[model samples]
Target chain A: MREDKKTPSVRKLRVRKSHIKTRLVLFLLLTAALMLTVIFAQQICPYDPNAQDTSISLQPPSLEHLAGTDRFGRDMFSRILVGLQTSVLSTLCLVVIITVAGTAAGILCGYYGGILDSVVMRISDVCLAFPGLVFALAIASLLGGGLHNAVFALAVISWPKYARIARSQTLSVKNTDYISAARLAGGNSIQIIIRHVLPNSIGPILVTSMLDIGTMLMELAGLSFLGLGAQPPTAELGNMMSGGRSMLQTYPWVIIGPGIAIFAAVVIFNLLGDTFRDYLDPRNSRRN
Target chain B: MEPILTADNLTKIFDEKGKEKFTAVDHISFQLYPGETLGIVGESGSGKSTLAKMISRLTDITEGNLFLCGKEITRVKGKALRRAYEDIQMVFQSPAASFDPRRTLGDGIGESLRNHGVSKVNVQKEAVRLLKECGLSPEFADRYPHEVSGGQCQRAAIARALAIRPKILICDEATSALDVTVQQQIMELLGRMREEREIACIFICHNLGLVQSFCDRLLVMYEGKIVEEGTPDEVIKNPRSDYTKELIEAVL
Candidate 1:
């Protein structure tokens, strides 16, 4: 009877393990494919993304132009490929900046809390208090219309969320017995923070950053859509959508193509992030 | 013989500037000579763990002096404080929580050796040897804290604490979380280690019965103050203070 009960449990464990493995592998492959396309955007484009061909202007999807042609007669497919490169790369840069800076500030504050911690935490509160997009809009306009400025604006508003996550995570991990043990083992503050505190606290921070990818992508696009980002001739998804908005009804393909790209990018990253969270979640892994 | 560790009127006040200040360890003093096992028994919130923490320098000493082999370490900071740790080590109540969940048992055991400039290869060899000395299998060195049983993890924690060969070992309710059988096993292991190495120990636990056999001397604390001190048999058989009498009655 015990063997009968144990056999199913052992099989269940194997099944759960493989289920986690397969989903993780699938999403990882999809993310890799998306990154490769973005990296080789320029080389892979059949037609120059910025070049105009007036004779083919407003043409719908055809064998020659996969996503139809815009009013400027630029191939929508080629523009989208290049636009993805810009959007994805900028979002990646923004995520890296905030994750590194916010994590550093948080770990220091949480580990060695003093006047500096209170001051930085309050500043982050102020940043978080503002509506994210509106603040980004205000900063983007103040800094002038460009992709870099929009990213900078978004970065300023986005970092506080990461800081808050990292801070809370650090606070929880700080009091764990291992931290006390590390101190007893002759680890200095910096050594303790790097070895004991960071490793233990990093799980939530990484998941938050992964989930932020899609939100950052959308926010970046939102800024560009408002004319405060990626000025004309720069193939950015949001700018392309803005450029083709007026012709939404007459030549809907131009607007619809980039909209779909944005949607696909957002969905892909969000799902990947979700899967990554599931994979890293200890509760789920430990169940089997 | 000169005491290996000494605490002189050590006090710890939480939120000293706040209106509602709380004294965790108040004007406490004790001494641990080499090869001695000093057990501190107190009820919950009696500041037994706080006393351990202050002695090990994990918590800052709000006032008074702490000496290790005649060296004052009360105001030591930074690298000096870290260097002071070479003579003192601690094992906490929850053994599983005392090892980094991300690191293997070997890494946690060898961490001090690595920090003290031991070569990577030697640290690994020493860690494995320590694990063996602590009665854990060699394969257990590669396991994470969560992967091992509580008794096994506690043994690993003991191994890590002994890695640097510190003069003093502080076990703050180290076996309180384990089952009765496992607790006895750990106590035996601790006794064997102490006898083999002559490392002075400050064993903090609330269980009067458990410490009676293991400790040479016992200090009964009440509300952060030492209420009574004697050898385990003397205190348990003939308590002096009212609180110690009450404690002994409750246990009996």
Candidate 2:
């Protein structure tokens, strides 16, 4: 009787585990595909992304150019491939910077929580109070237009979100018995934070960063659209789209190509982030 | 003979500057001699846990002097504080909660040994051995805290505390979260360890019956003060304080 009752639950658990595994595998494969495309983008492009040809300017999609030619006569398909490489890679770089910097600052602040914490958190509060894109625009304009400056500006604004998540997670984990046990086990502050605090608090931060990928991508593209990011001949998706904006009615292929690339990238990352959140949640992961 | 641990008028005020200042533990003092099980019992919110926290140095002592092995450790910080932990260890109320959810039970058990300079290879072996010693299977070392039953996790917690070979072990309601049968088993294990190692222990709990059987000396606390103190038999038989009588009556 007991075996009969337990068998269904065991089966349910197995089903759930497989479901999570498949989702995780799909997400990883898609992310890897994006990364690989970014890595081999230059090699894969049929024509130089920045090369100009007045003879083929404003040409429609055809056998020669898959995404047609922009007003500047740059092959839309080639520009998009390289442009994807730039946009995705830079977004990844920006995410890494903000996640690392924010998590570090937050852990230190949440753990120690005195003068340094107060100062740093207040600064983050100020950063968070403003509209994110507007603040980034202000900083980007101040720093002058470039891919690096745009990333820096976005990073300056976006990091607080991760910091807030990390700080709150840290604060909640700080008082748990495991942390106290680590302390009683003779672990120094650094050891305790690394072993006990960071691992426990990292779930929410990771989820936040995963979800932020889509947002960051859109924001980066937005900056480029506003003429505050990735300059001419850079082959960034946003820049490509921005350059083709004037010719959108006349040569819709140019704008649509980069638009589709951005849309696909955003959707993939958002779905990956959703799956990551589901997998990371302990309620769903309790194998016992 | 000197005491293994001493708390001189330990106090803990929750808020420093506020309209409402609450004293969780108020002017409490006690001493634990070597090779003795000192039981601290009180009703809920009587500051038994707070007193335990102060003695273990997990929570800051608002106003008091804590002397471990006759050295004043009222305000020690950093390296010195970590050094102090080698001599003093704690098993908290919830066994599962005390072990890091992300880490294996073996990792939590071996953590102290690793932190105190034990080699990586030896730490694993020692952790398995400790698990076995605590009445758990060697395989339990690899399991996460939530994977095991509460009793098994408490046994792992006990193993972790004993790993450091500390002179003083503070059990802050360590077995309160377990079932009666499991509690009895844990009590028996603790009794055997006390005889074998002669490790001084501060066992904090609210269960009067358990304290009577397990403790060598009992301190009955009420409103953060040690209202009564004696051998468990003496206190239960001839209670000096009204709170002690009330506690005994409540148990009956």
Q: Please report the candidate that would top TM-score against the real structure.
A: 2
Candidate 2 backbone collisions, by pair: none
- What would the per-residue lDDT of candidate 2 be over residues A171-280, giving only the tens digit for each residue? 99999999999888888889999988898888888888999999999999999989999998788989788878887787789889999999999999999999888887
Position B47, candidate 1: lDDT: 96
Provide candidate 2's TM-score on chain A. 0.93
lDDT string for model 1 (A54-126, tens) is 9989999999999999987899999999999999999999999999989988988887788989999999998
DockQ, candidate 1, comes to: 0.80
Cα-based lDDT for every prediction:
0.91, 0.90
Query: In model 2, how many backbone clashes occur?
Result: 0
